[model samples]
Target: MQTVKPALPRPVVAVICDRISYFQHNVHAVPETYLRALHEAAGVMPVLIPACPELLDLSTLLATVDGVLLPGSPSNVAAERYKAEPLPKETLMDLHRDETVFSLLPSVTAQGIPLMAICRGFQEVNVFYGGTLHRAVHERADAIDHREGDHARAIEEWYEDSHLVSVTPGGLLATLSGTQAVRVNSLHHQGVDRLGKGLRIEAFALDGLIEAFTAPDAPGLVLGLQWHPEMSLGHSPLAQQLFTTFGDSCRRRQQSRLCTKSTGGNDEFISAYAV
Candidate 1:
């Protein structure tokens, strides 16, 4: 008999789309950096999950992908989702994304799919798990000013590492980054106010705001960051480490899927549907 080799399944990651308006036309968009990271750094196929309510079917989609990437966006998570009234000047909300991401989380947690949630995605994870957020971190009594000096400055200056985040020693975040402290850019005015269910702090900023978090109780890998690793990868070794760790998790999930499919074995963590 001729020798044969087994084929490995390609890992597929779902990257959520964003709702946008351009020239009076509605658009569903995904950032090029995020797509590039998933393809170039992570070496996985990224499927853009549409933000439209009418289109998203959470269970089916979650069952098909090895991981999920919740990328940052210009629109902010609406305050109303966490039972808070919106501020007068709150960034225009993307209710489409808000609802879609919330619906997707329960499935991701239950299915053991690795998740890399960044920036606004971090806040969404907080809210999805029953936590609340402060409207503006800079305005809070204890929170320091976490924004660049002027909005008119060049984009490079805006994304520069403006502050340091102290990682929890021996925690998941520290294990992933291999560092106790890391300097990260400050771009957000809002931050976590109350922690959500099953979520734990992984790192905190100098201003005492939560900068990164993970869900310990969840079956799969979950890493949430307040800063943008997608923007910092070139100069930040920690950024490269974070993405590499996440990519490994996704590959593991893909292998698990292949195993179950071949053997018809029961794996609650990798199961597509609940019994």
Candidate 2:
């Protein structure tokens, strides 16, 4: 008889898609990079949320998944969401994605879903909870110019480690990175000016700009990184740890959910996850 392989459980992670214009038509799409990394890097099954919030059942989606990934995007979140004036320079803005994500923030944080917010996603997390961001963070007097340079180059070149960010001691990041500092790619123009409620700093750049944070109050893992861990797959231990830690959390959540169901537990938490 042939030996059979055990089936690996894929922890489901909801990936928030962005609205984009393609082939002269507007549609919702998730970047391939995010999907690839979710599967290959994070060891999770990604379910794309392409439609507006009105179409999707949030509870149904949330109950099934172990985590949520808010990926970076070309367009920036509208400033009006956080009661700020628009950027002085012309910038691409996506109200559709902004609306969708902003609506989802409450349930994600409230339910304590594992969340990994990146780049533009970083800004969204801030705005979602009454936090503000510098319109042009690089120009801010106290912070370093964190933008990826003006020279046009291939995508791979842009993601290389550019500067070192000091991971806050005794925090999650410091533990994960196994050190006090880590190099990260700087490709964003907007950064946190004021943190959101229930959020705490995880890492900061050399010039004192917030690079990563965690929600200490939340039940599950809620990490927001200014740098792109998804892009730093094999080479960086910190990046790999970020995904592995998240993947492990999702796995535990999946196990807990299954155990709750298998044990005939009919409590509030069990009922919720059983979705």
Candidate 3:
């Protein structure tokens, strides 16, 4: 009789949330649509993590999860935190969500966890690591028209083709996209100005706005893109590649976790058994 092999566990990616106000009640929430697309694109199950303003020790959550997915949200980070004036009109701000994620990022990166940051997540990752934002791109000195029309009104407008971005040579994004220029969906008004510590700019908009960044020194994957790959998954091979690469990294991390557990901290046992 043939010996049976045990099945491996599916990797879990934590999707961080932002504050949402509905019916006079405030709550931390993430869009179900984005979560669905992430699962479809990456083949990993997502766990929604509510926005918490208090500093969180990530070890508890990291022990059970393989990777992190920072989703986009309507709430903007308060300019006061970055020593800049507020936007003309103060957009909704979530102190708790911003504080929690900002506090947890260093520990997360230290553990060498794979992080996939989209839109606001991208901004958060940048700001958390000693970077600054443009606040409102249109208000800046040299800005391009970036806001895609309102969601309900722009469904038929093809917002995804609003901008073209160029990837930097020898960057991970350049290798992933297989070409310098790629058309991307744009719905953001804030962008990175000075890059974060240990990060390198990977791509930029045709108008010279920072579009993507990555931490080259990080042990695991640490990538941030200004556009929404979740929204463009159906039509963009590059979008698929982004999620697939992240999911593959998560799987490898999961396998390493299992190996460590099975070996009971015995390095020689893990090495021999892994081979």
The TM-score values for the models, in the order shown, are 0.89, 0.89, 0.90
- Cα lDDT of candidate 2 equals 0.84
> What TM-score would you give candidate 3 relative to the actual structure?
0.90
lDDT of 1: 0.84
- lDDT (0-100) at residue 154 of candidate 2? 81
lDDT of 2 by residue, 86-205 (tens): 765578888888888988888988877788899998889988877998888878777787888865898788888999999899899988878988899989888899989878998899
Q: What are the RMSDs of all candidates, in order?
A: 4.5, 4.1, 3.1
TM-score quality measure for candidate 2: 0.89
Count steric clashes of candidate 2: 0
Total backbone collisions for each predicted model? 0, 0, 1
- Runs in model 3 deviating more than 4 A are 53-57, 86-89, 151-159, 262-275
lDDT of the candidates, in the order given:
0.84, 0.84, 0.81
Clashing pairs in 2: none
Clashing pairs in model 1, backbone N/Cα/C closer than 3 A? none
Give candidate 1 misplaced runs (Cα > 4 Å): 1-9, 263-275
